[model samples]
Target: MLKAVSLGPGDLSLLTPAARWAVEEAEVVAGYKGYIELIPDEVLEGKIVVSTGMMGEVDRARQAVEHARAGRKTVMVCSGDAGIYAMAGLLMEVLESEGLLKTVPFEVVPGVAAFNAAAALLGAPLMHDFASISLSDLLTPWERIEQRLQAAASADFVIALYNPRSRKRSDHLREALGIIGRYRRPSTPVGMVRKAYRAGQFVEAVPLKAVDVDKVDMQTVLIVGNSATRLVEGRMLTPRGYHRKYAL
Candidate 1:
């Protein structure tokens, strides 16, 4: 059996029990080098660990599938929820294309996604409706991403941005801000959380127009509040209609 386990966002404490158990029970573990390093040394001791660098996801998924086919319990490790722009979907596609989807039994173990983790640190900015969108155009086209951003912004949905910016994609976040700025107020609340719950964690809430794009990178998750969102005593919050449905 193969298990796709989410390791959470850089914090060992954020790892779910089922994810930890999947790793503990696996004979082989495969994932990107950075994510693998997040696991405790003791857990990987004496285990067949395969570490791959960036853009080697296909190779890593193939290795995990092969190991599972050979009767070795294997786990494909990913940061955050594996299904959310991670290895789970890729692994499934590979297995299906290779005619092994039904032959090999697999399960996905969920963990704290970056947006949820960042939202917790920033308070309840997601108390109302929200949408998550990735700014990376490596696989997805920038045009499609823009449409989604425009729709989410125009609808006043709280937006969680993943892969907001990177070294090679420095201008993407600024472009996204421009698109969102068309629909949202310049004073809209925006929360930025970098390396949430991990070492060197940084969290800040600023106005949408005042956001420092340079401070945002791929490791950060930015939550742009909806029209109903507010900053309450330094914390970001969005009402859940509790005030209207009942007296509070």
Candidate 2:
């Protein structure tokens, strides 16, 4: 059996029990090196670890599938929910390509995603409709991402941005903010959480115009408010319109 487990943003406490059980019961564990490092030492003490650096996702997935086919209980771990910008789909693709999709037993153990963790830290900014977009253009085209941002902004949906910035794509986030700026006011609320629930965690709420782009990186999750969103006290909030029908 193969299990794709989510570690939930490098914080063990946020990792779901099912995900931890998948990892603990596996004889072989395969994942990106960074995410593998986040697993508790005790849980990984007796497991055969397969780890690789950046751009090695396909190799890792292939190895996990092969290990599972060999009758070893194998698990692939990824930070946040595995289905969200993680290894679940890639593993499925590899399994199908290997012709073991039907024969192999597989399961996905979901956990708290970055946006979920970020939203909790930033208060209820996603109380209404929202869109999640990744600024990374490695696999996705920039044109399509820009179109999504434009649509999400124009539709007045709260926006959650993932992979907001990286060394090579330094300008993407700023450019996205620019596109959104055309639809949102300069004073619109924007909240950023870096390394949420993990070491060096940082959370800030500021106006869209005052965002410090240089401070953002791949570890940061940015939540841009909708037209009706606001900063209440220190929290970023978006109303659900229940007030329209209720008396207080």
Candidate 3:
């Protein structure tokens, strides 16, 4: 089976059984270099390995398909969830564009996305109305991102910011925070989750005013909850389930 599985942040524990199976059983494995260490070394012994740095998607997808075509069951891995800006989309795009879908069997194994992991770590920051947007200008434009952030904030929707920053674009996160800060309260709860589920996992909740955008990178996901969001016993859950369930 040609499977695209999510590794769920960087933590091996969060790698679901389905994802593990695809990784272990495959004769060929394709993934980014960051994922090279994440693969179980025992399972990878003697397997055909293909890895690349970030942003080499088209070539990587082609390599995976080449290995799959050579009669090897291939598994392509991505961090966080498979469907959220991961290899699954690129794989499908290549297959569909080349009309290779019928030639190969493919499946997507879901994993815990960064935003969800961050929310859980921060206490239910997404329990109520919320919206998510990726800040990386690599795939989406900054203007479009600004529009979405403004709209989400204006609609009073809690916002989850993904791919907040990277080495090439270090200032994007600060710009995003500035945009949201205009609409959100300075005291609003903001969560930053990094290395989620991985060995060096960290999750912190700070007021909007206290956030240090410079420290944020692609490894981090930032969740900015609406004004109504509260920390109950240090949990970051919004009030949808709690408020609606008990409402008269």
Instruction: Give the winner by TM-score.
Output: 2
Q: Name the better of 2 and 3 by TM-score.
A: 2
lDDT per residue for candidate 2 within 1-248, as digits (tens), equals 99989898887789888998889889999999989999878989989999999789999999999999999999999988998988999999999998998889999998899999999999999999999999999889999999999999999999999999877869999999999999999999999999899889999999999999998988899999999999988889898974587666
Model 1 segments more than 4 A misplaced: none
Please give the lDDT score at residue 132 for candidate 3.
90
Q: Sorted on TM-score, highest at the top, how do the candidates line up?
A: 2, 1, 3
How much does each candidate deviate from the true structure in C-alpha RMSD? 1.2, 1.1, 2.0
Tens digits of per-residue lDDT, candidate 3, 40-156, equal 689899998899987777899999987876678999988888888788988988878878799889899999988888887888888678899988887677899999989998888
Q: How close is every model to the real structure, measured as TM-score?
A: 0.97, 0.97, 0.92
For model 1 the TM-score comes to 0.97
Candidate 2's clash total is 0
> Candidate 1 residues 1-248, lDDT tens each?
88899999878788888999999999999999999999999999999998999889999999999998888999999988897889999889878888888989989998898888999999999988899999999889999999999999998899999998866779999999899999989988999999888889999999999999999878889999998888888789898864597766
lDDT of 3 at 231: 57
Give the Å shift of residue 176 in candidate 3: 1.4
Best by lDDT: 2
